[model samples]
Target: MTERGEGSNAALSKYEGYENWKSNIPVMYDWFTNHNLVWPSFSCRFYLQGTDGFVPHTLMITNCDVVKPRVKNAEDISQFNEEEQSPFVQRYKTLIHPGEVNRIRELPQKSTIVATHNNSSNVLLWDLEAQPNRHPVNGAPASRPDLILTGHGNDVEFALAMCPTEPFVLSGGRDNSLVLWSIQDHITSLGSTKGSPKLGPRGVFEGHDAIVEDVQFCPSSAQEFCSVGDDYRLILWDARSGNAPVVKVEKAHDADIHCVDWNAQNENLILTGSADKTVHLLDRRKMFVGGVVLPIHKFEGHKDHIFYEPQWCPDRASVFASAGEDGILNIWDHLKVVGNNNENARAKTRSAPSGLFFRHAGHRYRIVDFHWNPVEPWTLASISHDVDKTGCGVSAVIMLGTTMKMQEQKHGRHLPVYAFDMLRQIWRMSDLLYKPEEDVEEEVEAELIQYN
Candidate 1:
């Protein structure tokens, strides 16, 4: 995505190009709508540019059924009926190619087109209410973005969380602040030829003493949001409120907080991982130490500084998975407190004592980030760094371990074995699978041969 001022002219050229492509390309209508010979599914695509001060470059749509294309010769264009030749019709005629006339004839009447520029300085919204697809170009635009949001003081490091409600987006930056923006307004304001769209901050959450590392909205509530920072603090805020956090937890870890996630099942439960080599679970309702902080558990197995991202299981709220700087990824179950009557104490006494379900230590270098696939709960993805004689590279590794198997081996002496292997750069089991002394090498060798 290009920056605001830098991309406007280029985006306008692209917008014109899209119009020309729509008019010229016959295959786009068939490809986009799947040639049902009738109505088809419609959607919008957005393009954005810029980092420090970005803006929307284009907002166009394809709603070709309502507005029919008006044909006119180059010399007799002025003679075309003004009432019949709307702005879209004139623009469509100018943009489409002559050879794609057959495709335009098959255009659906009810299509929608939407595009956004980078950074978010400029936004354009096509009145697709009346206009339909008359442009003919297919895959003419190299890239199209639906929304372009800007106004970050520094480069954005990561995508924190998207708003569960409303057309809003939230992001954290090195500037030490969290920004909430209304993307819906940014898109709606594009049609305004008057003053610049009133695209400004909806709310600025500022409790972090250091650069904010991560920001996440409660999965259950739209108004509730949480942010973690390098200052070792996790602050919970009501987005409708002002700058100060409604609730705050201090000294979350001894080191900087790197990542945080909220429990999908419980809005009050928050999980945070930090450089202090500890992960803390805090109850949002209990803002103070004297206010009953629910300490679920903490994992302290990593030998080196932890750098991997922590994620919770999609199916089970009490289960969470994490990877670390020690090149090990672990899955842990947060022992649930049955009732309010010292249930945790009772369970601790009767249980065989479970700490970690499965641990995979196979990366050549440190595992940078890991993610649990939403589609398959048992599957996971890990990105790791490799700096060996072969050269420096990054690998995406997939792990397949069923949750049922993990629970079965919860307190067993032998943990359930899970497979971890490389995905993109090469196909091989991680070094963790190659323990020379174990007789299991014979079994692993056979497995490797089968995969190869």
Candidate 2:
């Protein structure tokens, strides 16, 4: 930070360390990124490396563009505003209460939150836009339940998922049951201040003999969905009818199946993670050959831990990633998983041997669940058990950019890092991340919007 009285050369002399580091910014940026671990976001550049004794807190960059401008190129960045320019994370810490919050998910529109708890049959829903009173407002009720889904039997519910195209909530439980809840009916009941009838499942699907670990609706259709369970069974159910499964394949895997996901682009492809320490990509069209649908591609890399919900990349349909009980995030491209480049490699490995494209060791304990950002395919959010060795539990969400071209990130004289319009658009909910007390966007719109 140079004083007004100091000239350019004098300021350089006054802050020798800053001058030295500023000159090496571009070189440092280039040295820190690559094909395996790309730095997709602008904030990942100088986030935890501003001070003299600083190095970046985390290193997980995958791709970079040499042509884009660096933070040093910003014409009028205020030196004192380091927090705004280089905030690596924006954390929101509010406990959901009571339940251990085994799994949490943000809806497709990013407008609501749904969470499942350990040893509980009920599913909880909280509207993101709601501003309910946290404390007692004249002794009425403190934090009334937004919507309590009482559709399950006595057994604990394990998984909950929202349909992207419709207002339906799908949940599967240890009671060996699946319940479909209508969001419209829940909201309608909340709107009636006089209080309406107790809500119930729009439809209930039942067939699994053991605990239901995961349930996910197909990305393209609201009526169809799949569930995996401890009984080593994969059952496809129709939302309109819940009496029995449309398709149930017994002995689906060697061990228990932990989770399941639908391909974002291809409706026929299904992905499943298992306690057997392998991932199977299955084709729903002909999975049941002689009473069993064989795996199209099987991946083995997570060693001895469970891979919790292997997800298909939203942007790149062929690319997918998985979070495992081993506390690692592995990204894979079905075409590039195995090291075989021969002409018959695809044909040979289509049903057999496959490997990992990239692996990220981020968390310390078991990672129970994770979700790909609906808007940005490269971005992801993962939550860990955080166990006895570390803290209690930690839930993490990171938005990775860089699939499309991006402008250089520069800081300015006013506002926070979010004041930059380019960043604001990249994360549509930037306003919620930084609650600026005063107007800062007006002063720094022209420079940042060029990137947007």
Q: Root-mean-square deviation of each candidate, in angstroms?
A: 20.5, 15.3
Candidate 1 Cα misplacement greater than 4 A, ranges? 1-146, 185-199, 291-294, 336-354, 389-452
In model 2, the Cα lDDT at residue 426 comes to 15
lDDT of 2 by residue, 1-452 (tens): 11111122221222324445434433322111111111111121111101111222121112222222222322222222321322433222222233233444435543334433434787766542352323212323223345667788855544668888877788888788888877764564453343324457888888888888889998877898999888889999876664689998787778888789898798888888887778888888888767656887777777444546788878666778776556556777775543357724654556433545444443444444554544332444444332342332222222233222344433211111111101111111112112233444643464478767
Which one is best on TM-score? Answer: 2
Candidate 2: where is the Cα deviation over 4 Å? Answer: 1-86, 91-96, 113-118, 133-142, 188-197, 337-355, 383-385, 388-452
Candidate 2 residue-wise lDDT at 377: 24
lDDT (Cα atoms) of all candidates against the true structure: 0.43, 0.51
Q: Using lDDT as the measure, which candidate wins?
A: 2
Minimum summed lDDT over a 10-residue window in model 1 is located at 98-107
